[model samples]
Target: MTQYIGRFAPSPSGPLHFGSLMAALGSYFQAKSQQGQWLVRVEDLDPPREQLGAADSILRTLENYQLHWDGNVVYQSHRHDLYQTQIEQWLSSGEAYYCQCTRKQIKAMGGFYNGHCKPLNHQDPAGCAVRLHIDQPVTEFTDLKHGQITLPQALAEEDFIIKRRDGLYAYNLAVVLDDIDQGVTEVVRGADLIEPTGRQMSLYHQLKQPTVSYLHLPLALDENGNKLSKQNHAPAIDELDTQATLLRAMDCLGFAIEPSLKDGTIEEIIQWGVQHWSISQLPESTEITPRFSNGSV
Candidate 1:
């Protein structure tokens, strides 16, 4: 029998926040309930957004909360060679092409990109990016949480870049490759990334790799409707009140709260939660953002 496998891949932009814990808990319970392996991965490919020691802080916080992970953690920052190999393989196979078209060129044509560089023998300088060719629709899949979702045509079928113009790999390319590398059987992440579901599915097809299950959890937003993130200055998770924080996160994910267990330890609360965990128990619609009026940064 195939064991269920899931991952919580956090970017090292800042210390793990309340919203981050919700995602980690959802993935953890989903994996643990099925006796599956749950892994932690750091998506630190984008250096500009990464914070110093942020990954270590996140891992320490998770451990303190008793959200233990299986095996060793994987960091995308160390996987550049794998990404390059795949890029080369696709290029040799005519599945990818070098693109020289500017963003303005794409907009002038339409909001969508036409395969302008797919058949070109043009000189693309150091800043050139490699793009994938897609002449057919990438199609749709039913989301475990949000039901049937058909992606935007431009995104699903457009000639999207695999490598960045700055010689870096794009997030879409890196994530698909990393998921494949880690043998991640399922993904549980924020609803904000639901749009990329179809694109990721398309990559699976291109590589002839098996598709993985996905669950996009609702994003935590501020009062202004902005997603709680480093940019929005969302507060870091408080280690002092870990159980309280975890319970609050579970509530945000629609898990039933036990008033009697209010002052319990993290392990005790997690034990109760894992035993009662059920995907059917989670809310299908987007949930309200969990916020503290006292404020934090």
Candidate 2:
């Protein structure tokens, strides 16, 4: 039987919040339940958005919550050469082309790029981005948690960018490449990213690699119904009370953990969780507001 491999990839844009913690816990529980390897990858590709020391802080929080990873942590910032190599190969094979279209121009075309620059075949690297030529689009895919998901035709067929004009690789390109490099068999993440699954699957097909399984857990929403995310200034998880926060995260993933386990050590609680975790128990809805006995998360 093929070994199951899962990963928790967090970007260093900000500290870990309840939403981020849910993703990490979901991925961790799913992997450990199957006796699979759980790897950690720090996505620090965008220099301008990353916070200094955020990566170390995230790892520390994971450890404090007893979500220990299996191997040496991988950083996207260190894998630029690999992304570039793939882009070069695609460019040579006519699978990708240079694009100079700006966001405003794309918006003018009713929000999705119509591949206006592909025929231009602009060879100059300066002031241009590289886009994947989407001759065969992946319109739909099945999720381990959500079942079959269908994507809009415009979104599925749009020729997306691989490398930005600023020389940074796009998230879809970097994430898919990194997952392939780590031999990740399943990707467990937040439901907010469900839209990108089709695009990532398309990239996998273009690379001649089999698509990995996806399990997008329900998103944690704030009181205002906004997603609890770094961009929304969501407070970081309280590392001081790791037990309570860990329980809240597990609850968000639909685990009815016993109250007695809360008195146990963090490791013990995690062990109990691994034995009890089941993907079928997870909420089918996309968003969920975490419940707390006290007025705090």
Candidate 3:
């Protein structure tokens, strides 16, 4: 049997908030439960949006919470050559083409790219983004947690961009490539990314690689009902009280920590979690506002 491999990829846009921690811990527990390898990757692909020192801070925070990974952390910024190589191959094989269309033009065309540049065959790489030509788009995929999910026809059929006009590799491109390179067997993250699963699966098909399994946890919402995210100014996890924070995250994942282990150490809590983790116990909803003991998330 092949060893199960999972990862927790975090972007260096800000510190890990409660929602982010839920993803990290969920991935960690899932991996450890199966006695598999759990890896860490810093998705610092977009340097302009990345906060300085945020990557290191994320690693340190993981350590504080005792979420040790199996190998050295992989940074997306260091793997530009790998992405460029794939793009070059796609271009040469006519699987991808350069698009000169701007965001305004795409918006005018029903907000979804209509594959206008494929026939144009724009050669100049200057001021042009590269888009993969989707011959057979994946409209639906079975999520480990959510079951069969069908995507909108336009979204599933759109010739999505692999490289941006600003010379940055798109998230869908980098994430799929990185997951393949790392030999990741499963992707355990938040449901906020559930929409991109089909696109990523399409990339896997394009690359002729088997797609990994996906387990998307429920999205943690804030007081105002928005996702608890850095973009929303969500507060960072309180490192001073790692025990309480870990328990809260576990609760969000549907783990009812036994009273015998409620006051356990961080390592003890993680061990108990791994031994008792069950995907079926997870809440069925995609978005949920977590409830805690003290009326605080």
Q: Predictions ranked by TM-score, top down?
A: 2, 3, 1
RMSD over all Cα atoms, model 2: 0.9
Runs in model 3 lying further than 4 Å from the true structure: 293-297
lDDT of 3 at 42: 97
Better of 1 and 2 by lDDT: 2
Give each model a TM-score: 0.94, 0.98, 0.98
Give stretches of model 2 more than 4 Å off. Answer: none
**What is the Cα-based lDDT of residue 161 in candidate 3?**
93
Instruction: Please list all clashing residue pairs in model 2, or write none if there are none.
Output: none
lDDT of each: 0.83, 0.92, 0.92
What is the C-alpha lDDT profile of model 3 across 54-119, one tens digit per residue? 999999999988899998999999999999999999999999999999989999999999989999
